[model samples]
Target chain A: MKKFFLGFALVSLLIAGVLSYFASGDPDGLDKTVEDTGIAAHAQEHPFAGSTFADYALGGDSKFTGLAGALGVIVVLAVSFSLFWFLRKRPDAR
Target chain B: MHMSDGLLNAPVSVAFLVIAAVGVGFALVKARADLDDRTAPMAGLVATFIFAVQMINFPILPGASGHLLGGALAAILVGPYVGALCVTIVLVVQALLFADGGLTALGANVTNMALIGTATGFVVAVALRRLAERGKGGLAAVAFVSAFVNTVVAATGFVVEYAIGGAGGVEIGKVALLMWGLHALIGIGEGLITAATVTSVAAIRPDLVYLLRGSRKPLEVRS
Candidate 1:
């Protein structure tokens, strides 16, 4: 089970690292809707727009962006595992 | 669909934030009851995997693309309670770390993608699973259908939110119609990926798929 999970996690990391670079750069459904409806004018910049790694990349370099994407996956894994670890029922407790 | 700030007024934003917080909190408590050591990592993996998948957007129409929402897929893999919690964490991480969704609009996003999406998808999958015969392609087919429906419902969620709190000048009905139409296309992509993923996992790790648990049976000996 651990081996399978590790492989699964590795595959996910690869997709995020490599395949994400090939993802369409076009605006997504909501963004396109805002543009089509002329509501794009009302969309405000995120308060953290200037933060490091904003938009999932640092300087628009493809390699850096890919690395950042991989890092994002790891960060999510770590955080979620931490949360679930606490929330999981311990069999020995009862 | 990650809505930025200013799309909704402060009151509407606050209202959704409160609602989403309560919903997620309830999910956490509920999930804790069912989550054991073995299942805990599964839930975490679902969240992590979906976060990575969400980055890859496929073009649905001219100049418009969509990404995996992962609500239905997660619900089908794990149960709905943990599924919702997983996606909520993904949304929170996206908002705070990547800024994919607006910080102010986090509540609305969570409500749409986490609460409503997973709930509807799980219910739909279970209903379809019941209607179909066991141990065939039925489970995978229902997974696709559930995922497709999940996206449409989530899209409608945005429409409802916009109606209640839209700051733009566009007609509410028109936006709703367009949102629905565009998401229908996006839902196709969502459905296909979900079907493929669920089927793949069911093939290798059938025990991991909560929706398929009932359908699995011991191999029969020929007379």
Candidate 2:
């Protein structure tokens, strides 16, 4: 079980850190809908747009974006692990 | 789809935030009561996996792309309650850390992606699985259909929210049509990914799949 968990975590890291660099650069479905319908004009910048990792890019470098992606995955994992750890029903581990 | 800030008026955004909060609150309670040691780890892992995959977009057209929503995928792997919570966690992180989703519109995104998507997908998948009355392959087929339908439904959710609180002059009807149509294509990719993942996991660790729980019958894998 531990092996499977480790392997899965490693795979997730690779996908976020490396494969994410290959993701398409086009607007996503929602963004395209906004643009095609002329609603893009009303779209405003996200409140956190100026954050170091805003838009998943950092320091104007693609490599930084990859680093950001990996960091995001790890952060999410850690946070979620903590949340689930506290919330999950543990029936007295034998 | 991550709805950005200013897309919907303040009233609309607040309303969704309230709604999403209620849904998430309920899910948190339910998931807490239901999760075990095994499922606890699976839930965290599923959320992490989803966060990673959501970064990878596949092109649907010349200038458009879509990524995994992962609501159905999570619900099938874990339970619906845990699945919704997982998605909510991912969305929260994306909004706060990556700014990938809008901060003010976080509520709206949570409602569409986490609440509606997981609820609809889980219900549909379970219904179809029972109807199919087959085995592993059939479960995967059902997962595909449910995930596809969930994406469409979630997209429709945005359209509904937009109509209520549209900040732009765009025609709501046209926007709905485009959103639904494009999302249908995106949903195809979601279905394929969900199906493949569910099938793979079901093959090796069928016990881990929430959908297949409590089944005494043999799950014949049709090659």
The best candidate by lDDT is: 2
DockQ, all models: 0.80, 0.82
Candidate 1 lDDT (Cα, 0 to 1) = 0.84
Quick one: best DockQ, which candidate?
2
The residue-by-residue lDDT of candidate 2 on B31-104, one tens digit each, is 98658888788788899999999999999999999999988999888989999999999999999988888877
lDDT of 2 at B28: 92
Identify the CAPRI category of the predicted complex in candidate 1. Answer: high
> How much does each candidate deviate from the true structure in C-alpha RMSD?
2.4, 1.8
Which residue pairs in model 1 clash with each other?
none
Q: What's candidate 2's DockQ score?
A: 0.82
